[model samples]
Target chain A: MMVMTQENLTSKERFDKIFEVEFLPQIDALYTFAYHLTYNEDDANDLVQETYLKAYRFIEKYIEGTNAKAWLFKILKNAFINQYRKKSKAPTKVDYEEIINFHDEENDTNYSTHTDLREEMFQSMMGDEVTNAINALPVDFRVVILLCDIEGFTYEEISKIIDVPIGTVRSRLHRARNMLKGQLKTYAESLGFKDKRSKD
Target chain B: DYQELVRKVTMYLDNELSEAEAYLKVLSQEKSFREFIKSKLHRRKPSPALIKSIKDKIKT
Candidate 1:
């Protein structure tokens, strides 16, 4: 959080300083988020560009010393919701029951044997799979999870950014995690790492 | 019970709970829960290429 003295500098100077100091460091994180939300590289770039342009135009109104990332995220989230997400639907839907039943079928496989391999394999596989699973979440859940889990924002910060109550953030994060866990479980089973503890 | 367990594990994973409380809650769970927490805590970061693309976009 960098503070700009409103009285000391010209508006353009202030904007440039803020952009250089506060916004630039967070650009990568913001783009990653936009990319995940849009699921298209080009669209993600455009969305992030638009977000920055809006943030710059409205720069004078932004209070100094506030959470810059959250402010930027608010701008980005609103842009995504009002403009982009409204025009698109999820590419696919996965049934949780089907995943669970599939895990049940693989109950005979041993988890312990794969526990060592699990770490390395999962580490390599998780980034793409997690991104895919997150992108597949409903709009609300996806936003909440991205803010809380991926971007590492606090619940209060997310509340302010998304203009939602803290309770909603909690519930949405909970649901999102469960959905993610279900997806990961299915992914693990597909890789033949059965939950041996299920038998116990 | 499963929901409660999930909530506890999630809170613990996020470090939202106090250490003593998290320890107590986590101690009561099955071995799988512990393993789950360990795996999750150690999950890999996003790819460098993904991160690089983001940085490149931001720089432009």
Candidate 2:
């Protein structure tokens, strides 16, 4: 892949080069993120298309050969908040940040005794159990878990992508994992899998 | 202390922490922790048609 200087590249060439090289490769990831956000195939496709169109319109703002995935993700996330959430009339998110600040004990006391998610159970488990559990979470927590645990974005990158502080990302991730564990535990018990926390 | 350990373990798995980060060393030695890190949720892939649509949208 040839790296083109922004100055030398014409408008068409720059859009083509960046769109093909930097943006298109991220299509699947952007789609997946969009799907998780919208929970509908058509809506996800629209969100991704809007993101790409928006990315092209603002192409000069993008630095070539940089973190294009994060850049695209930020655009998609903002589009979801600004457009989809409003269009759907989604309920306003209560400020988890305020609760997270004053309610520190809830974080430690509730989760301290919990064991890590057992791999053996999840191994035997099949289908959309994991995906369903993730989807069941609130959008804020869901995004962190997807970005960190599933997509493997760094905390710094996730913070920037979601436009939140890194500490908020960490706290949301921690809380999200705990919530996911509770949900999965219920699911495993329903499937006759034993809780091995006491044994471990 | 337990909450701190969980934080470290999550950070360690996410590669946000250094290898020699304290407490993570012991947790990393556990089999459950190792396998848990490898477990992932299923991700939806964009349909081929969707992919083509984006490419066409960008080209024109």
- On lDDT, the candidate that comes out on top is 2
Off by over 4 Å in 1: A1-9, A85-129, A192-200, B18-60
| Candidate maximizing TM-score | 2
lDDT string for model 1 (A1-200, tens) is: 75757654477676668876786667777887887677656667767777777877787888866788999999989988986555656556687997997687567476556665868766675566555676678899988877766677888889999998978888888887668767767766666656442311
DockQ of each: 0.17, 0.39
Residue lDDT tens for model 2, A32-139: 788877667888999999999999989989999999999999999899878856766877677788678647755676444432333444455435576677778998
TM-score for candidate 2 (chain B): 0.55
Model 2: per-residue Cα lDDT over B1-60, one tens digit each: 366777777777677887556443446433243244336555779888887887787777
Q: How well does candidate 1 reproduce the true complex, by DockQ?
A: 0.17
For all predictions, the C-alpha RMSD in Å is 12.7, 14.2
Q: Residue B19: error of model 2 in Å?
A: 5.2
Instruction: Grade the docking of candidate 2.
Output: acceptable
Going through the candidates in order, state the TM-score of chain A alone for each one: 0.70, 0.71
